[model samples]
Target: MSMRFGSRRQGRLAGAGVLAAATAGAALVAAPTAHAASVHVVTPGQSIQQAVDASRPGDIVQIMPGTYQESVLVNVPRLTIQGAGAQRVILKPPAAATAQGGAPKASTPDTPSTAGAASTPDTPSTADNAADVTPATTANPCFTTGTGICVAGTEGHRLKGVRIQGLTVTGFATYGVAATETDHLVVAGVNASGNKLYGIGEQKSVRAVFVRNHAADNGEAGIFLANTTQEEAGALDLDGARVSGNVLTGNTMGVVLRRVRDMDVLRNSVTGNCAGMFVIGDENTPRGGDLTIRDNEVSANTKYCAPNSHLPFVQGAGIVLTGVENTVVERNRIEGNVGTSQMSGGVVLFKSFVGVPNTGNTVRDNMLSGNAPADLADRDTAGKDNTFTGNSCSISQPAGRC
Candidate 1:
């Protein structure tokens, strides 16, 4: 497992834990989710940032067809930002969003590829190159970190029915979706590609949902949901989140879920994406509740998705964990995920956990190939106290116990 690095840099404890909503629907769990609210329309000149600034809580901000060059920052809480269609509302900055501040720096040098390019032939190999492709997409194509598609901040944000489909989000400075100190976020039908930091950076966010999204050709990782915030004890800070029906490729990791609790990751496709799914806790913080990873297709992350990406000594894994507890890894197909780091196991449980040893987790009924199991069981786990049994490569990782 990687050493749990965050944007915080060389030093600092990453964050807190994930608080999941109870398992099952309303009948199975208490406190059901409310229905989505009504829609509000937006137009040109009326940029999304202005509307978000003007919108009241519980109101919706719907975007219309146009290239919204303005770098939008949403601080309002409990408001929805819906796009008419991915093709209609074109978000991003001209001349690179981050480059738009005042005048050009003049002396700044053009960096190499910010997003991963097809250099190493992994699989489904193609003879034609990036230059030959029609309507070519620029590498690291973000409008700019501060001036790209939808940069939402604060709490209770929602992005739905978006048509950010056909547009290319590239040449940005920061993150695609830089969500911090936020909750109840919903992002769907978005094609987030060619970003600087992360395609979607869900930092210190809670109760978020990412569905029907496509992320590719970005630097760093795709979908980075980290529990960087701490709630009161017994309150369960971040809880009951889900990532489903999405395509993650050509990024450091398909979906990196860290410090989340009681969440279910299901029905997603991670291919040609580096490190299909990464789960773990920070070095000494050592706390996150049950995570259920099931029923997904994970393959080829090494060839296309990651190709040659590496962070210092850590290579990558299809499903990797470091000091995580009370989790389930099952029903997922893991095949043909290749990595350079010799220790890149299909499923890895790093060194030992902090605080107490990681316990009460199960790994069963998971298919594996191109990679073998890292360890038969978690080294930090106490035998019998933590069940270790029933896993099939052809079946599901959580078929029984681990």
Candidate 2:
């Protein structure tokens, strides 16, 4: 492995954790109140949907060990869906909606699974590649395409306190676990893999805690946080989001934070993807920042989405900051991110938007090595007030900056 390091003389930057906590606390003030207590037990071959339909706010739906082939949407407030264990309980899409049930759909000509210009001669062609295709915007892709578990709340009814734990969600056309316009949600110890889009995705949600989860081998991002429009973002708390102790790999991006704020992404293992954590914002409404990315192992992000995909055609990076501000990257192990483009590196800061350059960001005290092009890259002239201090690296792409 070719290792390169870049930095000026180092000093300790304090209160990173404290700032993260304070930011998270400020965002939680808008969270809804608690719900009434109720518990419902569901076994295999029984209708989990029926149990969900009968449930009220603050109800706990405990599921036993079995393969439940149904797409469940949780709209009830404060609903807790707990399985026996991630390995014991499996939630798959229904047979009719599954990609494997009928005639194999042909891969898109531009898809990575197909014989594209970028595809190697030895690339194995398979029907499983069809699972990675993007779904339409007019419908709920989970039902139309397929999804394992979804916590959906409309703009009028913003669901609160929905908790999902100990479940393995796989073989879905859309997301394995998805949520929108919800609050106070906890997704723990879940294995979300082999899904079409993201392994886990949340849009316009608040106070979410994703802990001890494994999100891998998805088509898009492993864990995605998106706020596309202001109306959708308005329903979110934007306070504290806790993403920790998770293994994210084999996806377009490990964790994608777009137009999200006040998040703490810590102690996670992110690797073998196109890019690790991406903190992005733009000139549009509800731009995101205020993140603390620390204490994680981020490496070997060497995959990219197809050119025809809706996602940006970004290559490997341990972490990327674009059009974002007031963010911190500290105390992490970052290395080995050689992408298709020369911009690939351990960490990259760029101005993704025209007027809104990435500014007021700090890259401090990170252990970076073995990254191609260089360990650190400052790729935009618009990026201002950015500081790289105390990072233990040998060189940067631009010579004198280090």
Candidate 3:
């Protein structure tokens, strides 16, 4: 009996020892690692891409005052790229001579190739000649065509919390700024101009804000938001975008939203483009929900025809809503949208061949004047559900009085 009792006691002690060993191992495995944030200052002669490559998440890349002839691609989360000032910090493509050969000519002192890795701000940087082998064209496939700044993400790898501030991005081959499948992004106080395509392009992205920026002289729209679809369900995720307090001019369209939802376009000055704004719906991607356009100064957008562009020339229009539903246009100063075409007007609504009608749209209490032919027009066959009320305009089409 004594031997049996001693064996039981030893057995219980062995079980307790095993459990304590397991607990100790778990505590070691679950220990947290330290993540330190870093600040990398990029001077005139340092390569921003090299700085980005050395950075982890939650790092700041500060660009000093100079012209950087390079395209940047940012895929890291919680990353901040700040410049000294918009006009002082210029990010442009390499000169055509440098871009063609993918090497610096050694004649230009400011080439991006001569720019080395990151250094302190007190250390003056050499000019760098940029190459295409870096992160320049490494955006999403939908946004790979652009050359300025591309912020993108892939499946299972979502990037968020990015801020781009106080930079002048210009003279690129395509879009000045392209954000694809990203979220919580902010593009503020930047001047994006003279690109071959959109000044700022957001595709399949959500919760993006564009404020206090200037977009001009782009080959396409100043600001474009589209939902280019993939085979998966919910692939086109264009939602919760706010475009306010910006100046859009000298593009094909100032602002264009296709298949976007819950958009607010307010307090913007859109002028001197092909069309001030366009909300289009088509068969592949249907129109989205709850668009509000108010308190904008939309004028003088009569340059509707351009070469090598596919947008139909809709003459003399401040805003055009086609095949859209549940939209509101109010309190805008729309004037001087004059053209010889019969379809030209201050605010026009039309239908497309997509079979979805423009229903439940409200055009009310807008200040309109000097618009040629009319101040408002409804050319949709299924335009019965739309309401036009309390508009302060001289002339309206389809025999309406407001």
Candidate 4:
């Protein structure tokens, strides 16, 4: 079944203003300071944390090529932390620290689940919900928090204009990189792998960007964004947050955007995992939606994952959206994914665990092949105003959708 999707020129044209505003916001964050910013360089064997601590707002902390052992934290605003390159600069746990293994899981205030709802044996609670290592120190909270790098801010004083780039962070117990209550944050050209949970994660943040990065071999989602991991809450407006030009593989899921709105997931290569992408929402105020998933290559996500409290075992799922409204999925290349789970498909609209159905979503112009169950699966019969048109696929659930 081959059908031509209608032109989206009007939508693109209407969104130009929003894109411009987001670009301007990013520029303002990256603009040069009135006074020259200081640069602190750290070589191998030096304490990166010390350098970071010494830095003031708008300062640059440059890490030289070498393997370093220490967790770094950035709380100051307008700070730039850069490395020589992802290959040359590596951050791991301290030598005395024991290596933590197995997949990382997340426990809500009321219920427990793995990151993005995929799990395996020996899973530990995620950084946000888990207790810190013994003898946790206030001077460097990240040291015992099991996070390689953490940008932390309270709701009253959000961290703003922090940039992290060109580094490799791996082998941590929880997230390789994490941020909370942040604004105008940027993570670019980094490699985060071998972590127990998310490679990179952000919660309660807005106007964030993740670009040109590689995330692999993580136990959970390579990149995860959410409103709050600690408790159930309403979705947050992301102010045009974006995930683009990244390679995500060998994780439970490539990317998970949970309870967030006004975001873009574009031009990503996702494969070799249980699922490629998940857009999850629930019965809450300002339900997650108004996002775009476009121009991505998703394929061959055949890794098996065990069932969690929220979801059944998921494999070969390209993109799954639940309880979201007004979301657009278009112009993606999805193929070679095969599984029997209800969520498995090239593009699936599934019912939310809380019984909320998808609403006003669109799936169009995606090329799909070799997907089991069905390429286009509208599993949410109760969903409202969901449309499937202009797709190039041979099979779809309930027939005639392709």
Q: Which candidate ranks first by TM-score, i.e. highest?
A: 4
Q: Give the Å error, residue 89, model 2.
A: 0.8
What does the lDDT read for residue 289 in candidate 3?
A: 37
> What lDDT does candidate 1 reach at residue 143?
21
Error of 4 at 336 (Å): 1.0
lDDT of each: 0.51, 0.68, 0.67, 0.78
Per-residue lDDT tens digits for candidate 4, residues 113-220, read 232232232224435424323222234333226678889877778899888877788877777898888998888777888887789988889999987778888877
Pitting candidate 1 against candidate 3, the one with the higher TM-score is: 3
For each candidate, give its TM-score against the true structure. 0.65, 0.78, 0.78, 0.85
Find the candidate with the highest lDDT and give its number. 4
Q: What does the lDDT read for residue 49 in candidate 1? A: 61
Model 1: runs farther than 4 Å from truth?
1-40, 44-46, 94-170, 229-236, 283-286, 304-310, 313-316, 352-358, 372-388, 394-402
Q: Cα deviation in Å at residue 272, candidate 2?
A: 0.9
Candidates ranked by lDDT, best first?
4, 2, 3, 1
Tens-digit per-residue lDDT, 1-402, candidate 2 = 101111210000012223323433343344443644566899999867778879887667889999887777778886778777666788876654554662123222112111112222211133343443323222342222355677877775668877787778887766788887777777876778877667887776788888767788887678877653222232123678888877888877798887677889999889898888777766554456778999999998988754553234667777888777788999999988877563478888866634467878999999988877778888867888889988877668675444
For model 3 the local lDDT of residue 384 reads 55
Angstrom error at residue 37, model 4: 0.7
Reference-based TM-score, model 1? 0.65
Q: In lDDT terms, how accurate is model 1?
A: 0.51
Query: What local lDDT score does residue 11 receive in model 3, on the 0 to 100 scale?
Result: 38
